[model samples]
Target: MLASQFSSRHPSTVALDTGLSLMRVAAPIIAILLVQDLFSREFDRKLHLTSLTYPRPRYQFLLGRITAIATLLLFLLIILASLLAVLTTWISYGYTQATPPDLGLPYVITVVFIALDLLVVLAIGTFIAVTSTTPSFVLIGTIGFTLVARSYSGIVALLTRDSTLVGNADTYQSSLSLLGYLLPDLAALDVRMISLYGDWQFLPDDWPLRVVSTLAYAAALFALSVWALNRKKFS
Candidate 1:
């Protein structure tokens, strides 16, 4: 169900395009190099040259290889994010929008939140992949969840704006307003807005609420996902 939206698109998983320029460009090259040299050399040199490998043993080796790659990926994400943050700071130094790296405790919080988000996503993908016995299901589900979240955010923001949402002081209007306030409003934490905009375009005041909200929501989602995975029994 989660992946339905992703599969709906023809040629689904052409994810050959999404990501930061440096990562999007460098990742595949790096992966190929690593796999060809390290993975292939280790496995092929050991198995084909060393001995015959069985399916179970092959999966074990592949799983170990994936763990190493995932670790590398985590570090890659950290470095990439740190580089972007540094570059943004360097470019925007002395500008009005320049907030210190420690500004309002958002950096650490965001990093932790994003890490947790990544774990939840990977967990969801792994669980679904294992249970469904189809890699596409996991791929599509993760992509679909992201797409659905984006769509839901857009509609909620459009409907809750002052003109449409808080139009009148009627009871129903107040309730609608309160509901908007309570629902997980994600548009607030859009970090891209800060990175793309010129310095001084926005203040901490403009985005702090979003950071807090996203962190809170991320925690809840992660907890729920973990609980679900723990309870799920695969046949």
Candidate 2:
């Protein structure tokens, strides 16, 4: 359905754009499930107790679980990015766009940013898994986190552009702006336009800040998860 909407554009560009968009949604769900399985299920089935019996410190166990989940996500992202690249290339074999889509560095950067975005989701999921008593909260909390973190920036921008759009635009913008500090703006990490249009103009001026913010947010959540796990009791 989405492909048909983009039928007027370059097929390869459309394919890459649509594929990455779908991935932006799918990756978080996959990461949530992986974190749930790694952390939540272990607690649920009492397997965590056996793992805790090892000589290693609780932090090591938590870190090891995080590492394993991150490695799997990286592997999956690589495979999907490679497949998308190949598919895009194949589609563009004979045809040519007025402005050729960049399948080079731009595409690679887009994929990397997407991976970073997924890492934020993974971190949140891991945090919830460690901190929450209910296994179901891990899924629900992470999904809610992703939705708000990804869209809040856009919502705030809309409210800013037209204050009359809302009855209490000032209050809402102030609230979301405060949240902007607390949440990593995952929307800014979206660099798909750079790849889709092969235009440097689409490159975010504050990309370095965005990258740092993402890493810092994920690292903070991870540290909190480690802290929670170290103190967690399996009753």
Candidate 3:
């Protein structure tokens, strides 16, 4: 399928490409669908009041739920990586008589990026769930925001290019600068090229910055969701 498109002469590339293929198509969708009802269901069924009456603070409860989801996803990702490892070995044998492929630090870092991306999506989904009154609205908002966040940079790039051709680059470039600061550039975190080329030069060297930015963005969303939940009245 889509994974075959990323297949390369290198076993490492095959493993990484397969993993990215799965993540590209499935990660955000799975993360959103999993967390879309996190808080909305509570509001819909009138369970938020009961949950708020617990001994712990509100943020702690939210953190617990988020942590639980993250842990579950971690387990699933581990299984996925392990399967890819086995597949890489099989592919390696077919391509070369070398020993089982040894995935290097790059693959490890790529896995971290994939996990972080999922967490970012989860945080956005949680925020939508917390703010929305109905599960349907939560699902819609989460999907909408995910699509916007993922493509915002590309959309701005297109606008800036068009504006330049029209001799009005300043207007669009300024707006694009403002938007670049406001929205998380999820594209910056894409390391699929590294997996495809099996080399560091294939991807941006400053990828760590992207990972840090995403972490900060996810933290902000979690804080906002907690704040919103605290301000809300269960009645």
Candidate 4:
């Protein structure tokens, strides 16, 4: 429907971009809900007590829950990506844009990056779920983290372009730069232009490093969650 309504000649590109943009927003919410159900709700209802009674160690339970949620998320991503690909292909039929989208490798890579982004969010939510006593904090913290991580780079870039537009722009930029170390700049993971324009130049020079850093960050969070769960004493 979005493809048919797109005013641009490249309705296929617009359609895929719009669909992906929607997925970017929706995926985090879905991941947070899964984390809440698998981890937060278990703690909230004291269901973990029964599950922990199993001979398996606490880390095993934590690992298994995270794995289950991640698998479900991956499956959903694959289905959505396939549907979007079909829609884009259908829209592109007959009409040819000056710059056709790759729709093949580039599209697959874009989807994989999105999956990584969701994994990072899931890991953060899982960590918050295990450490925070209040189950609600898991949702709040995860959403807050997502908002900050996704937008901070853009905010800093805007400030950098015109310091005179905002008073004390240096202060804001400096603060954001410092905070950047702790938060993954998820916006950087969005290499959709590579797929949208069918241009490898759209891929960032540091994209491989960014991917590694994202994976490392998620792994570290998962490890912390496991540690937190092991140390948590239930009353």
Candidate 5:
């Protein structure tokens, strides 16, 4: 009964923790690996040409795979979010001070942002997978890109803040900013604040800009992937 009481008092907190945990694990890692496997498996089995023979435009195949993978990730997120809603509702009902569970707009929007973020990761992974000769290379390259993309914002921030360097800070900052524009800023797509705060007030004022930037980055990566796949010659 003590555990139940604890849950009752902390359901929202628990739900917030769950959402962040799920996003951290699902968005940048598991989803990327799964998407990478889509193309890696084709190459591994030497079925690239055969797979391409399906009655569709070249880009159709790529779009279809991306859509399918994104849909699967969305489905998983829905399932997890639903379970969290149910658990939070059940637990919070017993406590007098507990705020009612809200898996509504805030929760749903967070899931959408996560889905979009995973879409970008999928594009990057797909590009790496199509360009790589082996599955190992695909996995390694995707993971490396994921790490760099996700952390690029932080790395730039650190460099721009440090004044101990002998170089002119303005020049360093401008260069870093230019480099950042080219790098995928995964940090922008993060919506964890909504999960924790039960509202969008905690989100940055430029959240929409972040979403637009992420989509643009995804589009560019996808274009590159299509170009690479078209040029790729399979044995």
Candidate 6:
């Protein structure tokens, strides 16, 4: 009862969104602020490594820095995610002429998936930032991830599917299903089609597969990011 009630709460950026807003805003946090402090900041023209070796209040300094960076990013991302979600909702609604269609469940689901996807993005950015010791590398990696995911999504689908179904079938269901399954599968996670026009739910048997695939993708990406961070030798 309690869980359902909480779930029923009005749609907001923090709740359903996979935290894309935070991830989007997090670039400045990692690059501008955190990187400057951790990699660039120096007392007197000395290397940051100097402080690392001769640390004073090392633990407190690091903790405060991380907290400040994360907090700044969190709200920024929340706003961004919320704005995009609302924009998508408004656009779809205008096209469909359905106000709060399907009790706004599709909107709800889309927001949630976007937020979850951002969690993976954040993990990648944070890990890269810490491991590379330079925010430039991390920012580049994050942008690359986004571009690859968005661009390849359509190409992969076209190459995988038979010509007959390519035009009408679900984008992910075409030749792209393999890569779609491998990466975030933003196509599947995106419920925009439903918002625009109804009759879009996946079958019961395949629904579980979708859930498993998404969970696996998120876990795999997050684990890879953590692995990269763990191997980093802060020197």
Q: How many clashes show up per model? A: 2, 0, 0, 0, 0, 10
How much does candidate 3 score in TM-score?
A: 0.81
lDDT of 1 by residue, 138-185 (tens): 556655544444345565455556444544535544454454444444
Local distance difference test values of all predictions, in order: 0.43, 0.89, 0.72, 0.90, 0.71, 0.49
Q: Sorted on lDDT, highest at the top, how do the candidates line up? A: 4, 2, 3, 5, 6, 1
Candidate 2 per-residue lDDT, tens place, 1-235, comes to 3462466657777888888998899888999999999899889999988889989899999898889989999999999888888888887775677887898999999999999999999899999999988889999999999999989999999997899998989998998999887889999999999999999899989899899989999999999998988788789
TM-score, one value per model: 0.43, 0.96, 0.81, 0.97, 0.79, 0.52
Clashes of 6: 10
Model 5 alpha-carbon drift over 4 Å, by segment: 1-11, 94-102, 155-179
lDDT of 5 by residue, 1-235 (tens): 2234446456555655665566656556777667657878877887667878888777887778878887787787778777766675665555544344346787777777777767777888888887877777766777777676777677567766785663676676676677676776776667666755566676789888888988888899999989887787777
Model 1 misplacement above 4 A: 1-70, 93-104, 162-235
Ten residues in sequence with the least summed lDDT for candidate 3: 94-103
Candidate 2 vs. true structure, TM-score: 0.96
Model 6 lDDT per residue over 1-235, tens place: 1111233332322222333334434544443444345433432234545655654644444445545655665565556655655654443332333233332565555455555455555545554555554446665776676556656766655655555655655554554555554456544545544433333553233655666766676566546644654454554
Q: List the residue pairs that clash in candidate 1.
A: 3-141, 97-200
Candidate of highest TM-score: 4
Q: Between prediction 2 and prediction 6, which has the larger lDDT? A: 2
Better of 1 and 2 by lDDT: 2
